[model samples]
Target: MRKRYLITFGIVLFILVIDQVIKFWIKTSFAFDDPSVPLIGEWLQLNFVENQGMAFGTQLGGGMWGKLTLSIFRVVMIGAIIYYILKQIKKPDVKLEFLIVSAMVLAGAAGNLFDSMFYDFIFRDYFDPCISYNQVEGSGIFSECSYFGYTEMVEVRHRGFLFGNVVDMFQFNVIWPSWVPWLGGGQVFPAIWNVADFAISCGMILVLLRQKIYFPKEKTSKE
Candidate 1:
């Protein structure tokens, strides 16, 4: 691959890896069932969050069906971006930058999708504390709940399909004064996101800025 393409891919991969690592750590350690843990007194916190789909802290939902549909749509979109990038390889000099941006966007989208597709199978619900699954006092709570299969009080709240819901965690809030009159910051947003989000953001910013600095010049050949 060319240098530009490699750089973009590298950045995308780096962001994806870091994002997933942070999410996995939180999944194993924190209990987001109760978010809003106090960190740095009241500013930052280690909270685990899951979103059905959407960018950080936002979601479009009509329930599981909605999420599944969105997930499928995203899969198609990302696939298209990847295809576009591969096609651009035929004209490396002309299409390097486009390839880079598209690849980063694709990678970011895929990284988050990976979480939505698999996290549910391995872990239980996001709202419940992990302790609920641990075998307290050695007898094994699941064994204790063995009657679930035959009992009338069986309440099974299972995590849905891998793509059933997207993994979203990463909410950055900047508190502005309420006295500003017309506009003051409120609660800000919903879920916490990961590095994939950052990669996409950076790629988009670069592409937007690139238009001005690298915009094509009109042909001024021999007249």
Candidate 2:
């Protein structure tokens, strides 16, 4: 039981650290408009982008209120998962695989939540030419406008708690063949995601694939 707990804790800590390191590196090193850096041929690349919504850039609602709601939802879900893990750990028949998957999910959720809660306050030096003072109607938000043939420094302000954008960097450059239906000639899995998103997706996929092992059916007593 103690070994299992240590393993779970290690996995979650490792994932969270790796995810945050990659995100911070991209946030400081890459510009939004910078060309994607090829990693493995033309198939994989580092494409820096910020997601203001959920996975794959899907928004729950509009503007700041929506972001706050999403962040709150994540907190509730994480709390429930933690409770479930504790209960399962105490059970004699609990499967280690189940605990591992739960840890992955928990860590992934927490990783993104950290960004939503603190990225705005931590990352204030970022400047983008596309979103300048005149473009956005706000006082605290400002950027250097080199894209418009002019350049100027502007004061930067935090976007407040739970309103920071999630940084995404990895992208698959694969495109669907023309023979495909609606997605013909379009980028295949075009969503730019981060390490946390990948971890959550892998954890979910493992759950689906190994459901039988993780949740074995109970034997019925003879009538």
Top of the candidates by lDDT: 2
TM-score of each: 0.69, 0.87
Clashes of each: 8, 0
**Residue 64, model 1, lDDT:** 47
Model 2's TM-score against the true structure = 0.87
Model 2 agreement with the true structure over 1-223: per-residue lDDT tens digits: 9988898878999999999999999988887768999999999999988876776667777545667789899889989988988888889999988899989988988899898889877976663435421133333556664635776765432376887778888999998989999999999898988888888998999999999999999999999
Q: Give lDDT for model 1.
A: 0.60
lDDT per residue for candidate 1 within 85-185, as digits (tens), equals 66666553555566667667877887777776777776655433232322123222223243436532222223456443445555555465787665566
Candidate 2: deviation at residue 216, Å?
A: 1.1
What overall lDDT goes with each candidate model? 0.60, 0.81
Model 2 CA deviation exceeding 4 Å by range: 127-158
Could you say which candidate leads in TM-score?
Answer: 2
